[model samples]
Target: MAGSKTATLYRMVMPDHLCPSGLKAKWLLEREGYTVEDHPLRTREETEAFKAKHEVSYTPQAWIGDKRIGGYTELRKHFGRKQLEKGETTYRPVIALFTMTLLMALAAAWVATGEPLTILSAEWFVSFSMCVLAFLKVRDVESFSTMFLNYDLLARRWVPYGYIYPFAEGLAGVLMTAKILPWISVPVALFIGTVGAVSVIKAVYIDKRAIKCACVGGDSNVPLGFVSLTENLFMIGMGLWMGFNAFA
Candidate 1:
């Protein structure tokens, strides 16, 4: 057993670049009630020498007593946390976006209807989430379109559709939220949502192809699977409900 809670950290802190992993490692050590002895390699030569001596290729190495805890990732494993592997599929981005939009929708409902829980709240949640998702895609349309072409049948068939998708999604969402122009919004939402659902199902379930989702954004690590399906399903449900009310 270790005598005391002490950790030694070696990280890079160059004049031009401060390593993020190093800062994270230091923070993690402190959070775990360890007194950290931080060693900063301030130069490239120092970094190289340290790497050679330790026979390691990465920075932010930690040591607890005589046991080498490796890098920030290894430190996380030591603390019983799962570190995300490179290129690993994850639902974190979609989960975060939906969770945030849910809160925002509840807040909007409270302010507008004087009640947080209502049918309108659910509608606003889907509408607001769609708008936010569209914003992320349009933020870097080039990158989003490129990634979207990977699995989107419409985008693959007609490349221009990729560029128009974000704007169309945003317009439908805005109209739905304001409860106006159901004729326009309903059809638009239904079309895109149906297409997206089909594309995702074919790519993931039928083809069994591993891919990243462009639902949240281009740079997102969200896996192309259930969350994408859910997003499309929400839009479909909202469109159907709005259409029924508009025509009925």
Candidate 2:
């Protein structure tokens, strides 16, 4: 009797009644043979505690038997359904647009500073590189396999991290350009470096077989070996230098 089948599912969800995804998941589970019992939980602390006790996190988590499935998207996979895919056309066109916008913004800064093109600072270069990388990532996500892989560990982490990385880079760029908040830039830079470094380690050691970069919104190439390491080290060096000069 220790391994008898159970007909119930326990879901601890962020009680956002307006989320279409959450509603969709609830509907889907009910449609299946599941008796869904939902508990509303908010705040990171509560989420973490629940996860610690139940071994799950992220919104719309599903439990079948003792196994926990995190997020609405993952739940869909377990039930043999496809998750929503980002349209290729929708993402591809925006890449060019954002690239042009970033270039224009950088040009404006260059003109305002009256600094020669050759005199661009490390922060400016790093910021521009990140913007370019982000653009590329967006394009990469449009491919089919990138959008559909079920057990993408790197993608899981990278997608969330990607949301905040751009803002950090942009803020550092602004600080460097305006010649303000020098002290803060160092820590900011270091933070960026640390994230990149951690990302590489996760990709290589922890998620080696998990094919997909997940750095962009969609699935793309798995950045492995030297490629991941080099990218992180470059960022780390940029951050440390930015921090050092800010203090200097």
| TM of each candidate vs. truth | 0.87, 0.39
TM-score of 2: 0.39
lDDT of 2 at 105: 52
**Cα shift from native, residue 209, model 2 (Å):** 3.6
lDDT of 2 at 33: 52
Name the weakest run of 10 consecutive residues (lDDT summed) in model 2: 1-10
lDDT of each: 0.94, 0.55
Per residue, candidate 1 scores C-alpha lDDT tens digits across 69-151 of 99888999999998788888788877888899999999999999999999989999999999999999999999999999999
Off by over 4 Å in 1: 1-3, 13-18, 42-45
Worst lDDT run of 10 residues, candidate 1, spans 1-10
Candidate 1's displacement at residue 119, Å, is: 1.5
- Candidate 2 overall Cα lDDT vs. reference? 0.55
Q: How well is each residue in 54-142 modelled by candidate 2, as lDDT tens digits?
A: 65544556667777665678778888896555432223333454455456556765776765243354445555555555554545444
